[model samples]
Target: MKELDEANKKYNSDFVEKVKKTDVGENLKRIKIKKNVYIDSLIQPGFIYYIETGVVLRSFVDAAGNIKAIDILCAQEVMGLRSLIGRVGVQLEIKALEEVTILIIPEKLILANLQDAYHFLCSNFQYTMSIMYLHWQAMLSFGSERINYALIALAYYVGTEKDGEFFFPPYITHDVIASFASVTRSYVSRHVSKLADDDILVNQAKKMKIKDMDTLIKNTPNYQSF
Candidate 1:
């Protein structure tokens, strides 16, 4: 993991530089989506996703009848990478946790650009696997009773800030979060209050500023051992 992080820094930098260039000579063009919304809820349900800015979550319900968030996508992360390739439409509804600008490219256009479409398909398969792994880590992080679901959501939504504060917008209501964490709204509300009372969170008009991100991450109990 340590070596991967070091290698990732170089790849990420190069990726950013490549993305900045205006001339890529592909059939792809940019489309801006300014609204803060669930991506699956907004689009016509058949567009490819390449995020230019902001974040989104690709999630669905489990067979055990639990709604779970499977992915937290950020800038440079591809959207509908898994659901729209071989599939007709998205089986999992993607929710936008933040105001976003997604570059929607047509699936046909992307396919046309691929000389080796099978290779492209394989790479997308790996990307989907990566998202699944991240979600598995998040699930393990949340299954602990020692940690509140709100903290789980925050950690999943915004892991840690540069200033070591995990600032989160209060747009996430308890009711909406209920389905994701597989907890009742009342349970989520109770934890929200506890964090606020502990001064771990400051409830702003539209957001909750979480202080002490390091302590939150550290003190957050692990469930894997149990």
Candidate 2:
């Protein structure tokens, strides 16, 4: 999370301001998406989306037609890099987990307007690598430990923080967490109850919070090894 946070801080926040003064920017489509809405069934070519607020889940369908959650991305993240090369479909799907605002810019426009394109691309690469690293960590874990790591990641990526505690919205149900952890919903519920009993977490009515991060991390085997 530290590395990911640092990369986020390096993103050029001024990109929008610079774009606003240009003619192409005037035609930029910034759309508001409601919670639980699907952004697209298949990847769209020739455009990239800049998340302005809220979170989304990125998933892909396998040959078996089963959808699996691959990543959860939040504000300031840019998606659809493959679209720049005209890559379309591939069974990718994007769905809004929260009310989201996204700025859809043509690929050429992002390249033309983005100052420090190298750093921007690097930052995006860092974010992608971070998620892959987390997936690798989860692969080495098992049972509740896997769930623990998933919760920690979800907290960092999608939860809101206040006074050193992380609060996850009500829509982040056991099923949602189970998908990320590659576990069953019942398994997630059982482990979450154990965490609550230990006072490391608080989950009520589908909403959750990390009440004690140190204790929660202690339960996640090898979580700090990275």
Task: Indicate the residue-level lDDT of 175 in model 2.
Answer: 74
Off by over 4 Å in 1: 1-26, 34-38, 41-47, 61-67, 88-90, 97-99, 106-131, 137-153, 156-163, 170-179, 223-226
| Model 1: lDDT of residue 146 | 29
Tens-digit per-residue lDDT, 1-226, candidate 2: 7556656644735555555556453667888999999987433677767888988888876677555678877777777776665656565678888899988766666677666556666677777777788888888999888899889888876678899899997767887788788778899999999999988899876678999987888888767533
Residue 30 deviation, candidate 2, in Å? 2.0
* Residue 87 accuracy (lDDT) in model 1: 55
Candidate 2: regions farther than 4 A off: 9-12, 63-66, 86-90
> Which pairs of residues have clashing backbones in candidate 1?
170-207
- Cα error, residue 36 of model 2, in Å, equals 1.2
Query: Lowest-scoring 10 consecutive residues by lDDT in candidate 2?
Result: 12-21
For model 1 the local lDDT of residue 118 reads 51
TM-score of each predicted structure versus truth:
0.62, 0.86
What would you estimate as the lDDT of candidate 2?
A: 0.76
The clash count of every prediction, one per candidate, is 1, 0
lDDT of each: 0.55, 0.76
